[model samples]
Target: DAGVTQSPTHLIKTRGQQVTLRCSPKSGHDTVSWYQQALGQGPQFIFQYYEEEERQRGNFPDRFSGHQFPNYSSELNVNALLLGDSALYLCASSLEQGGGYTFGSGTRLTVV
Candidate 1:
């Protein structure tokens, strides 16, 4: 009955620092995907986790990583943050069938 939930609705960080964002997926879901959206760009796939394993990854650098738990929750980690890393981090969840998905509003990360 619950939808995807993301934490630290807004965050501020300095370059060279690492930040971790969290997410709780919707019920009856077993997969979680992470995305990063710049000010004027579409969301870029960060990575996806299913059954606690990373199934797919986007063009992001190694600095971007994610994890999925048995409870269907997830987390996104970015290391050595850069000013350009600032963006909205979204968490999406759905069944492996991929019929549909639910996305959290996102955590706004601002790197200064």
Candidate 2:
């Protein structure tokens, strides 16, 4: 019954550096999705994983990649980060049929 959880609630990264963020899906869920939300903007989907493989992806640069493990936890990695990467990274989880998604508070990444 545990909800999704993300680490380091806040992150600070420099331009051109790479960063990796982690997420743990809700109990009994097998799918995980990542989204990026800029200030005042709705979340933009990055990718979704099911069965430990990526099932759907959005229009984002190759720099954005992710992985889902057997435990249903996930990790998002962004390489050559840009100032534009500064945003909130949210992780959501749902069942196979993909009902309403449950999102974490998100890790606020600030690129300076």
Candidate 3:
């Protein structure tokens, strides 16, 4: 199944370059939300996907995008990468009740 099979991990991408990060949920979760967290700062919501379609989005630009597969696996694609984008990219899977967000242990992405 496309469900999660293990704990989520971090991904690092270079500055000014595009990168694709992958995450699979074993909890039978269909919703995937992405966030960018800078050092000493709270996580900033990027966007969320459900049922293989874009559902909700944060203030991030179009450069931040994502996709959810029919199998429940998800991908977060960052385009036109910039130095300011340096931070932790976290993927959370939940029912979108607006609470109880399950996320990976801070994935640090440093640019430069």
Ten residues in a row with the worst lDDT in model 2? Answer: 96-105
When summed lDDT is taken over every stretch of 10 residues in candidate 3, the lowest stretch is 1-10
Q: Scored by Cα lDDT, where does model 1 land?
A: 0.92
* Models ranked on TM-score: 2, 1, 3
Q: Pick the winner on lDDT between candidates 1 and 2.
A: 2
Off by over 4 Å in 2: none
In order, candidate lDDTs are 0.92, 0.94, 0.74
| Model 2 TM-score, all chains together | 0.96
TM-score of model number 1: 0.96
Those runs of model 3 whose alpha carbons end farther than 4 Å from true positions after fitting are 1-12, 96-99
Q: RMSD in angstroms, candidate 1?
A: 0.8
**Residue-level lDDT tens digits of model 3 in 49-106:** 8889999899988888888899776887789888888887777777755546577554
